[model samples]
Target chain A: MQFLRTVLTIARKDLVIEARSRELAYTTLFFAISVVLVFSFSFVVEGVALTDAAAGILWVAIAFAGTLALGRTFERERQADTLKALLLSPVERPAIYLGKLVGLLLLMTVVEALIVPVVGLLFQAPLGRAPWLLTGLLAAGTLGFAAVGTLFAAMLIRAHSRDVLLPVVLYPITVPLVIAGVRGTASIFAAEPNLAMAQAWLSMLVFFDAVFLTLALWVFGPVMSE
Target chain B: MVSVDDVSRNYGRRRALARVTLQAARGEVLGLFGPNGAGKSTLISVLSTLLRPSSGRVRYGTHTADGAGDALRGHIGVLGHDLFLYGDLSARENLAFFGRLYGLDDLDARVTDALRLARLSDRADDRAGSFSRGLRQRLALERALLHQPRLVLLDEPFTGLDDDSALVLIERLRSLRERGTIVVMATHDFDTAEAVVDRAICVDRGRAWPVAAGAGTLRERYRRTLKERG
Candidate 1:
């Protein structure tokens, strides 16, 4: 209960702050759209091939855009020097990590929603049999992404080269989750509807979420406290 | 209520604090006055369980500092220069956020009481980002007190406040002391120190010197002591 309370409070606060800024959310949305548009131009758009590639395109968009959004997750905290205050609080450190993770999850969800229609429009993809299932897989992969992303964001902010360092550190570490996420996404698009493949990817994502989030929680207090 | 013996912290070969020992009882305000880079904040960071001591030991209440820092955190609150507040959050939102962080059961009531105590009930809905320096400081005080912590560690709590705001804060700190909250505030401001704290300790080069010989003669003597130590 104590852990949940702290995490919820942090997530709520971040949401409120993001709502007030509007630009932070808008920035990620714009970035997501831009990535899709650029992909549309770069890849062949006139053929049925583009339609078949819709799931891959959407996952790629989310992954790239999420990387951008996650980097800015700690921007306001660092700018206002408010991290010190939060660290000094009696609340558990893992609570802060979970809170930030949830907050990022909320932001990424909004980005995902905006990209879904764009992906359909750009590629003219057919409506898949299990849209909700695809969304569930996306959320699971994102949970794992955000868990690790939050911890790295805190570390990246302190480095002398934040912009270059974040993606460099994040993408390589998150390869398996991304692959699982992309595969899980692809299965829904495939006419065969292989539950086994989707389940395998989803399970992999859940395992990654559990491990990375636990590690992030364990180290986040010591990291943020510094 | 708080005790530290031979406590030290270092990063690589750079020592932040070294072989420091101190103790404070309930209802006592232990002032940690030091110039910049004297390890005052570092020591407070260790005590607050934010930083681990490289060696030695610290104890707060029943928890030893080395292993059970989180256990100690429940009994401690801190007010540093960093308000750690969300700029877009209103006073009430800010207080409620922190209140929830502490897992307070009656969150709304606690937030209301904290707002009133900080004299911010009227502006409870104002965004903290737009607040003046003084108002923000007031809100920061409210944030520190939301958890009803037994010990409060304040780092430069009076830095940017005006005379009136500073006085109000001093009164609030005095009241907390009266309520038996052990406060250890760090500052270089002698006037505010004299105006508020019951006792002062001058910290220099990772060491602490209590001003016990003549508490009234602190302002002059504390200054001289720092100069000599430096």
Candidate 2:
């Protein structure tokens, strides 16, 4: 109960601050929309959209926007120099990691909510076909991304070139999750809609989430200790 | 009681602290007087367990940092050069956030009391970013003490404060000492620090030199230590 309370408190604090500043929200959403617009040129092919480009564009938007959110999340802590205070708090390190992951996931979810429909509209993909499956894929993929992202951002909070360093470190590590996400969504968005293949990819994503979350939780404590 | 036994910390090739030892008792305010890069902040970090000493150890009573774990951290309150208060959050919100992290049960009452201690009850609803340096410093100090830590570590608590703000801080330190809280402060400011420091140690060039009474004023003693020990 105590551990969970600590996690929720951290999430609530981040939410309250973000609510006031709107720093991450505005920056992430704008960047994501811009990404979709820029990529639309390549995938749209003059006037007609590519048949299977929506999945790739959607994940690309998410990954780019997620990276932005992850960077800013810890930047807030570093800006106020409050990261040490959070560390100095009596709560467990995993609770801190989990709280940050939860906040990032929430922010990414909002960005995705905006971008998914935008990608569907622009790319002419069938977003309404598998609403439940699409939500699951997004949730699992986001969890996998944020689980590792939160840990890395926290570790790099004090680095001199953290802004450049974050995505460089984060992207290579999260490629496997992104591949699974892209493949799963691609199957669902396909003309025939391969439900079985999509399910398999979703299962793979869940497995990836468990592994990344466990590794991040295990690694967060020791990494932050130094 | 806090005891640091011959602790040395290094950042790769550069040695930040070298074979230094110190002690502070309950109800005492120990001052670490030093110039910039003299390793006073490094010593404070080692004592706070924010940095691990390459050699030696620090203890709070019978428990070592590793042995006591989070419990040791729980009893420690640190006010670093940075206030660590979120600017977007209101003063009350900042206190409430940290208070929750410390798991204080009577949160509302504690937040109210801390705001009062900070003399920020009037501006409690204002954003911390809008606060003056003194106001933020006062709020930060109260935030650190919100949990009533057994040992308080402060790195330049009087850095940017007016006379009135400095007096409030001095009074608060005296009150903490009276309540038997062990307070350790690192500062270059001698005039203000001299008012509360029960014991003084002059740190220079990553080494700890015990302050021996030299002439008058902490400035004189500090200068004497540097000139004699250098």
Candidate 3:
């Protein structure tokens, strides 16, 4: 119960800061929309079919945009060395990771909420057909992405080249989630959506999220300490 | 009581602290004075459990920092060079956030009292980003003391404070000492050290020794120590 309270307190603190600044949400949303628009324009083919292109574009936009959000989120903690202050607190390190993951998830979810419709409108894809499945895939993929992303972001808070290093390190490890997300999203966006294939990809996403989140939780304390 | 036994810390090839031993009892204010790279802040970091000693250990009574882990941190309040308060949050919100993190009961009351203590009650609703450096330092002090920690670590607490504000802070440190809170302050300001410290030590080149007795003043003792070492 105390752990949960700590998690909520941290999450609330991040959310409150974001709410006041509106920096992360606005920047992430704008970046996501921009990515979608650029991709939509580029992926147009005169004769070639664009069946799976929409799924690829949507997931790529989210992945890229999510990185932006993660950077900014950790940037706030880095300012004034607030992350060190948080580390000095009695709260469990896993709780801190979980709290940051939830905050990132929420911010990414808001970006998706805005970007999904834009993707649909621009790509002429039917994202509204299976709203629930799409939500599950997005949630599962984002959880996995954030679980690992938060750890690396914190680990690199003091790194000299953190901005360049974050994506360089993050993208390789998150390949499985991206592959699963793109495949699952492509399956859902199929003319006659393949439920079984989508479910399989979703399962892969869920498994990766669980394994990485537990690993992240276990390593956070030691990695964060001197 | 807090006991640091031969604590030494290093970063890469540079040694920050070397075989430094110190102790502070309840109701005592221990001042650590040193030159720019003298490792006073390093020792404070070790005591605060933010940095682990490369060799040796620190003990709070019978429990070591390794054994106590997060629980040890609960009893510590640190005001380092970094303010630690979020600039976007109002002063009240920053206090309330830290109050909840410390799991204090009746949080609203505690936050109210903290704001009043920092003399920031009038500007409690304003964002910390808008405050002057002295005001920010005051609010940071309030945040550190929100839970009434047993051990308070202040690193250059007077960095941005005006003379009047510094005196106000000194009085507060005295009050904490009277309340049996152990205070360890690291600063270059010898005057503040002379004003409040029960005992002062001059640390140089990673080693520490007590400021000599019968010395003219902290400033004189410190200069003499540095000259002798040279």
Candidate 4:
């Protein structure tokens, strides 16, 4: 019970800061929209998007924007050494990690809510097709991506040139997540929609989320100790 | 009681703290005096368990850091150079947030008392970023003490404070000492520290030496002691 309260407290603190500064929201959202627009030009040839390009473009925007959000979130903590303060507090490290993960999930949900519709409008994809499966895949995939991202971002708080290092270290590790998200999203939005294939990919994403979340929770304590 | 036994810390080939040993009983204030690279901050970090001694151990009562873990940290409040404050949050919100993090009871009353201690009651709703450095430092001190930790480790608490603000801090430290909280402070501000520090030790080249009596002043002792040690 105390652990849960601690987690919520941390998340609430982040949200309050973000709500006031709007740094992450403004920058990440603008960057995400820019990514979608730039891709629309390349992927949509003369007003018609390539058959399978929207899924790739949509996932790419999310991946890039998620990285930006992850970097910025930890950057706030690093700016004033607040992360050290949080670490110094007498709470379970996993609770801290879960709190950060939950906050990121919510922020990313907002970004996707805005970006997904924009992607659909621009690329002429049917976003409403198999909505529940799409939501599951999005949730599981975001969880997997954010779980690994939060751990890495926290670990890199003291490292030099962390901005450049974040993407360099993050992209390679998140390959499976992006791939599953893209394929799952692709199958659901395919010309002749493959709901079964989407379900299979969603299952794979769920498995990935569970694995990543567990590993991240276990690793956070020792890694953050120093 | 806090005991640090022959603690030595090294970063790569650079020795930061060399076989340093010290102990402070409850209600005592130990001042660490040093020049730029004398390892005062390093010693404080070791005491706070933020960094491990490359070769020694610290014990809080009967328990080591490994055994106590979060329980050990629960009783330690640190005010490092970083301040550990969110510039975007209001003074009241900052205190409230840390209060919740520590799971303190009657959070509103505690936060109100803390805000009063910081003397920011009038500006409680003001963002910390907009406050002057002295104001931030005071708020940070109160933030560290919000949990009422048994051991308070302060790294240069007097930095960036004006005379009046420093006096407020000195008075607060005196009260903390009266409350039987063990405070270990690392500061170059000998005059201000002299007002509150019960015992003073000079650390030079990563080695610690207790300042003897018959001193001209802490600054004089610090200079003469380092020269003699050299």
Query: Listing every candidate in turn, what is its Cα RMSD in Å to the true structure after a full C-alpha superposition?
Result: 2.6, 1.1, 1.3, 1.0
DockQ of each candidate relative to the true complex: 0.60, 0.84, 0.88, 0.84
Displacement of the residue A107 alpha carbon in candidate 3, Å:
0.6
For every model in order, what is the number of clashing pairs?
Answer: 0, 0, 0, 0
On a 0 to 1 TM-score scale, where does candidate 3 land against the true structure? 0.98
What's the candidate order when arranged by decreasing DockQ? 3, 4, 2, 1
Give the true-contact fraction for every prediction, in order: 0.69, 0.80, 0.93, 0.82
Q: TM-score of the candidate numbered 4?
A: 0.98
For residues B74-162, write the lDDT of model 1, one tens digit per residue.
67888877776777889998888767666678889888998888788999998988888778888888888888889899888887888
Task: For candidate 1, please provide the TM-score of chain A on its own.
Answer: 0.92
Quality class of the docking in candidate 4, CAPRI style: high
| Model 4 lDDT, full chain set | 0.92
Give stretches of model 3 more than 4 Å off: A46-49
The best candidate in terms of lDDT? 4
Q: Interface RMSD for each candidate model?
A: 2.1, 0.9, 0.8, 0.8
Report per-candidate TM-score of chain A alone: 0.92, 0.97, 0.96, 0.98
User: Each candidate's lDDT (Cα)?
Assistant: 0.80, 0.90, 0.90, 0.92
Candidate 3 residue pairs in backbone clash: none
lDDT of 3 by residue, A175-216 (tens): 999999999989988888897899999999999999999999
Kindly provide the TM-score obtained by chain B of candidate 2 when compared with the true chain B: 0.98
TM-scores for the candidates = 0.91, 0.98, 0.98, 0.98
- Comparing 3 with 4 on TM-score, the higher-scoring candidate is 4
